[model samples]
Target: METKKNPNLEIGRNSSIYFAIGLNIMLFFTWRGLEYKSYEKDDFAMEILDIGEEIEEDIPITNLEAPPPPPPPPAAAAPDVITIVEDTEEIEETVIESSETDQDDEIADPIEVSDVAVEEVEEEVSVPFSVVENVPIFPGCKGKNNTELRNCFALKMNEHIKKHFKYPESALEMGVHGKVFVLFAVDANGNVSNIKTRGPDKKLEEEAYRIISLLPTMEPGKQRGRPVKVPYSIPIHFKIQN
Candidate 1:
């Protein structure tokens, strides 16, 4: 025997529609809960004024009169007479010379240069290597005249640079290479000083400085037969081979 349930009492006939409606309702409530705001209550008690109540005070009238200020003191009387006496001591007056002059004034005497004291000051002089009367002599350089001496000096300088030239190991590892321009001064005593080096890298500059500083003390360059300081410049190139 089969017993069939009534169509009106079927539980699962509209179950999907019910579940969708319920889910939508739950989502709406959840959104509202997330956005809910609350405020602290301000418990201010308000008082009502009763217009029918009568309030009165029995205050008495008080009369006050301020006293007047005191009078000022009288002024002292001044004497009308002034005395004069003859001053016996003579005061020397300074005479101020007038800067203005007229044609009547005589012209000053011509100054003789010999009468003026002249002081001679000795100052350090620096001359260029090319124009100097005497070129600084490097070690083992000898020549008969200034022209020969300049050539020998240049040759010796190249030889010295070649002898002392070195590559910095750090520079080699870093692949740093450049041409360094070096400017140095030979002092009046023929000592190397003021060595300045500029290059693409500091390593190259330091290497140039080291090589230039190793230069031996030379005979100071002369100008007009007086030994003087000299400035020289040269370029040193650094190249690395792979």
Candidate 2:
């Protein structure tokens, strides 16, 4: 023993250490390079996203909110309603009067009444005179004679007139009895000629003529026996039964 070992030889120990250190450094650098490469890849991805965003902006973009439309123009003012008013004038009519110029002509005239006013004269009225007779001048055929001629004339006339005429109703009803004075001329032949009523009742006068027309010619009125033309007045008396 006691031999002094010779110091082991540490050959390259320092070099190895240095080398390991260098290797670590190199690995670190390689890792760092890889990280840098990843970072570059990420940067390339971001650039592509940016390019998409720009393409989107370049394409037409629609805005949801549009600009407000211009306000509508104010409505036109309505024209005023103007009615024209005209004034009318009324005219009044006047009536004219007519004048008369006839001043001198008078319309009223008066009538004269003096001559009509003269009074009429009054005269005395004379009373009429009459003589009262003592007897009827015509006492019918009293104290008469000359029978043959009287009977013959009376018969002929009575027959003829009774054949022709009739009595009137008024005379029959009134018992119109009165003297009918028939004045008929007796012709020389003894036939009655003119026949008329001399004095008679007012109503019986016509009957008297009718009756006398029935009379025969008188034997001319005789004073003694012979026929003579005498103015004979005959009386007719008409009587009715009571």
Candidate 3:
């Protein structure tokens, strides 16, 4: 069916162009209303004054003289001369007797001196067992040579330890078993000193120390014909037999 078209619906097609033109016209009127204005100019009046010239005065001059120098001191007087007098007298000559002694009239006697013994002072020096020239001699290692004496000393020491070996009762009960290192020194006087021990347990260490301390006195070690303290170290084993 055919229907009549309204003109108001056709004007909507150009409505966007009409809105843009109206917005541009409104922005131009707003910019003109907010235009910047410059401040008004002010007039300044200047006044001139005349300055007078300054006058200078003249200075007076006067002459000055220095005083004369002081006079020098007076010279000292010379000393007077002394006169000497001489007397003529004769002197007599004297005869002197000879004081020489004859060898036949001289007497001589012999002087006798008693004997004096000097005590030797021994210096305490620590010498290692391996490097000592003369090793300490054990109780039963007498009459042995240097090398033989060293071996005998070691053997006797082991024997002594084995003979005196007794496990600590407390250590055995606690099952503490290990090797203990014992260090001792033979002094210049053939006496054992400085006994020390280290082990896993204090009981074992005490036992080792007891055994080492029981060692008999040995002949002191020597170096360069002089006796010296000998330091020796040994390890003792404490093991449980299965």
Candidate 4:
């Protein structure tokens, strides 16, 4: 028996080839549809810039005034003129002798030195009471020797101070009290002078000086048989009894 269809001409033989071509065509169309681009359209208007026209601004002006000039200075005075005068009197010229001498000249004879009188000049001397030959004599103080006179003078001084000592009221109120050392000198004329005092306060010094100033004039102390100043110092106590 023989087959009715030929093998090469069968319909189903190219079905796969046709299906592949159709599948490829569908895939290409699907890919093109997925990759499709769409955008909204916008309209832009055109405008032109004109820089050819120019703008101008106005500025204000200021005027300044100048200062006045200073006045001229005063004129100076003219200097005095001096005139020259010629001398009219004739002057006599004195002849001067030269002192140079030759061997023929004899030297003047030696000046005679016969007798020269010397004058005794007494100087101002100061002597201490202890070393003086004669101590200053206090009032009613008379002694044959220096020792007795010293004792009597010291006794008299103490008595005088006790008799005249008076404390200053100001010093008492101010409570200024101390021992004031009073220094005084019996001059060559036997007068008390140069009284000085040192103490804790001025009130005490004034009182001490006043007390010493009341001392009576005494006989001046003598050194080498001549009167000399004798310096004496005494302590004046300014104490409050209370």
Q: Could you estimate the TM-score for every candidate?
A: 0.52, 0.28, 0.51, 0.54
| Prediction 1 TM-score vs. true | 0.52
lDDT of candidate 2 at residue 40, scale 0 to 100:
52
Residue-level lDDT tens digits of model 2 in 1-242:
59655456655648888999999999999999888833455556443433344444466778799899999999999879978887687778886765554878576767678646787864422111111111111213332433544454455545555565455687777666655666765544455556778543566778667666555443334333434444344555555556
lDDT of 2: 0.54
Best by lDDT: 1
The number of clashing residue pairs in model 2 is: 1
lDDT of 3 by residue, 1-242 (tens): 87889877797899899999999999999998789566555544555776778767777786778888888888887768767767678788798867777877676765545455668975678999999999989998865478888889989999999999998888888899999999999999899999999999999999999999999988899999888999999999999876
Model 4, residue pairs in steric clash? none
- Give the alpha carbon lDDT tens digit for every residue of 1-242 in model 4: 97698887899989999999999999999999999987655544556986876766676787768777878787886768778899999999999998999999998977566665668887778888888889999989989999999889999999999999999999899888899999998989899999999999998999989999999999988887889999989899988987
In the range 1-242, model 1's lDDT, one tens digit per residue, is 89987989999999999999999999999999999998656766667977875668789998888798888888887878878888999999999999999999999999999999999987999999899999898878898888998898878888888999999999999999989999998889999999999999998999999999999999999999998999999999899977
Q: What is the TM-score of candidate 2?
A: 0.28
Between candidates 1 and 4, the one scoring higher on lDDT is 1
Instruction: Flag regions of model 2 displaced more than 4 Å.
Output: 1-147, 151-165, 189-191, 198-200, 214-230
Please give the distance, in angstroms, between residue 171's alpha carbon in candidate 2 and its true position after superposition.
3.0
